[model samples]
Target: MERYKDIDSDSGVLGYEINNDNITVWFHGSARPYTYSYASAGSIHVEEMKKLAHLGNGLNAYINNNVKFKYVRS
Candidate 1:
């Protein structure tokens, strides 16, 4: 996994990793990570997530507002 870029968020999303088909997110105080995919969130949402992850902003809000329950916890 790649290193997670730190971001400012009140949602406890510490960082994220974007892959070809999935995204793994690290929460501030959680031991487990959460993963989301195009299947669950759709292609458009996945693309937007990738953009937000690269920009190092709005990922938390995007997930919260868009795909909060669409992830698989690991």
Candidate 2:
């Protein structure tokens, strides 16, 4: 996996990895990662997540508000 970019967030989302079908997130103080996908979060949400991930803002909030508990812990 690629290194996660540092971002400003209050959701404990330390960083993330984007891929063709999934977004894997690394949380602060957590050893395991979580993966969200189109099947879980929908394509629109996934796209928004990609943008937020690139922007280093809003990704954590978006996940909490929209897709919380919708990801697979890995």
Candidate 3:
């Protein structure tokens, strides 16, 4: 069983379930779903998931990184 911290730390994802053939990642407060198939122990599929997680984190970082507020003088 996986810990909730692992899932909570991952943005847009609520949790994950590992099965024999694949892993299902729960997202959007468990409203959306994504499935991923597993390959060999050391395979591209695993790497792909890692990349996706990184990309997701990067996107969140980019969105939250900077902001500007402006007001026009009357």
- Best-fitting candidate, measured by lDDT? 2
Please, what are the lDDT tens digits per residue for candidate 2 over residues 1-74?
54445454355677788999889888888878888899887888888888888877787788889998988644
lDDT of 3 by residue, 1-74 (tens): 23223333646554455565544555555545445554332234534444544444432232233211111112
Clashing pairs for model 2 are none
Winner by TM-score between candidate 2 and candidate 1: 2
Model 3 scores a TM of: 0.39
Q: Kindly report which residue stretches of model 3 are placed more than 4 angstroms away from their true locations once superposed.
A: 1-10, 39-43, 46-74
Clashes of each: 0, 0, 0
lDDT (CA) for every model shown? 0.78, 0.79, 0.40
Candidate 2 lDDT score relative to the true structure: 0.79
Per-model TM against the reference: 0.79, 0.80, 0.39
Error of 2 at 26 (Å): 0.5
lDDT of candidate 1?
0.78
Across residues 8-52, which tens digit of lDDT does each residue of candidate 1 receive? 644557777888988888877888888888887777888898888
lDDT of 3 at 65: 38
Ranking by TM-score: 2, 1, 3
After superposing candidate 1 on the true structure, give the runs of residues whose Cα lies further than 4 Å from its correct spot. 1-11
